[model samples]
Target: MKAIVIETVKPGGYSIINADDPLVLSVQEGARGETIMFSLDPDNPSLKDNLKKGNMNVTCRDENIIIQKGGWTSIVAKVNEIPITYNGKAPFNIQNAMAAVAATSALGLNEKQIRAGLVSFSPSIGLSPGRMNVIDLDYFKAVIDYGHNPGAIKATGELLPHLSVGRKLRMAAGTGNRRDEDIIEFGVILSRYYDHVVVTETDPRGRPIGVVANLVKQGLLKGGLSEKQISMISDVRVATDTILNMARKGDLVVLQADDVHFIIEYVMEYKNIKKRQLSKEVVNDDHSKEGGQNAG
Candidate 1:
């Protein structure tokens, strides 16, 4: 029997829950005959009460995540065991892990299989590209993600504080098609977490070049960031290069990119080329000293 996993609501502007949340209602309705799995959230008592009416077949709760089915409860896995949860620092990811355990348990998967799968899962470029892809260099680290909307930006912002880095730099852009205010909001939200903001253009999607970048710049200015803190580069390649170049040792670059493949390829190539250049410089320096000694 297929089961449903309902994720918990995160904080910030994304946490706005109404009296008749459609997702909650859908979960309630789905519990009529089918097995359903849901995360525990104290804020939504009505949803909890609804689930308590002997409708929900399973539930997942945090703080040493456990999956409960009927009268049987099993410890699925620890939140820290999941790499995506970043050692349980990311609350949203922990909630997601719980939901995954609940759903997989309902699907007849044993605890060992579920634990093994969670441990093996990673959010890498080859696995889950453009969704929190971390690139570690000799000096700095870069995270490329598809955070386009206000809620997504806010979630990323909340996670930034937990990362170990010197300074947080953001290379962000918005589709030219979104509303002016929405585009501006991207910058406004980024200003909270990023030490420096590089505004750029995405696919444009029918709007003129620089329109999206300018809107984001305006939003950054409105969000208390000075012009010096923000830089507008219209070209995606140039913007990517600028951010990579600006990053120093211990710095972190959060890239909210449109063409994720292009960004990844460019960064990899750039790192390789830099290594080659440094090696050549060292070889040339050694040769120059040898020639001077021979001439002397």
Candidate 2:
């Protein structure tokens, strides 16, 4: 799939690619014309070789997203100014941004325009739904994501340490259409990153109702997580709410369900309910003080 695109666009076409990944870079072979490569490391061998040949390249240099085409170069924006990258703490998001820079650069947008677009883009329901949508409840936090594959799991795992330090809980589901080994691998990989794992509802395909969830649970246990830290909830909504309530102050809950949009909506509504509860508590405290003073 990767090589096919590169091969087809080989003639007089721009193939914006990620040079940091060797597996992906190998597809660049036999490609004719310009291939704009992007990388987090300015000194990456692929980026360097591309630049040595005067091919277009995008890289983060000196904490800035830098673009160099032959001899001319420009700095589009600083790493800290981009919110989607978690102020540059998320390596995966940063790499994604670099790819975006490569694409925009190919589109002939000047640095100024790209800078404006990058800064304004954020993860929101209206803008980017189901892609790392954060829900803050003024205490603990939760995020809704749509990534289901092992690679996506690993990338999110890479971003875990940079997230709010607290008890990390993940609410996940496995699709029956996926291979059993793939489902197990998904759980095993997540076990390395999260404190607790909630196996939620999934598409049964042809498998039994609980078969897929149990497989993930088996992987979680195999990955060294104890039975005490795992739960098999067959309903996505119930699993989400249960996990949220289980979390204490400052804890982090990551939600990955089949219906990402529904999860986001439910979590947001849950956040609003918590907000109202906090407000009522504050009002009650103020009224208690007033009544005590009046009695005195």
Candidate maximizing TM-score: 2
- Sequence-dependent TM-score of model 1: 0.81
In model 2, what is the error at residue 169, expressed in angstroms?
0.8
RMSD of 1: 6.3
Which lDDT tens digits does candidate 1 get at residues 1-296?
A: 22143233222111111213355455443333333444545234553553465423223346556654344567767777888888877766665666676557656688899999888888798887887777887688889898788877876678876774589999988777788888888778877788899888876788888877888888888888998889889888898899989998899898885787888888789879888988999999999999999999
Least well predicted 10-residue stretch by lDDT in candidate 2: 2-11
- Per-residue lDDT of candidate 2, residues 1-296 (tens digit): 66777677746668888877888877778565688889888888888788888888889888999998778788999988987898787888888888888888787888999999889999776688888877777888888888878888888877766777898999998879998998888888889989998888667789989989998888898899999999989987789889999998888888884686688789889988988998999999999999999999
Q: Check candidate 1 and list the clashing pairs.
A: none
Worst 10 residues of 1 by lDDT: 10-19
Residue 232 in candidate 1 has what lDDT? Answer: 89
Error of 1 at 286 (Å): 5.7
| lDDT (C-alpha, whole model) for all candidates | 0.72, 0.85
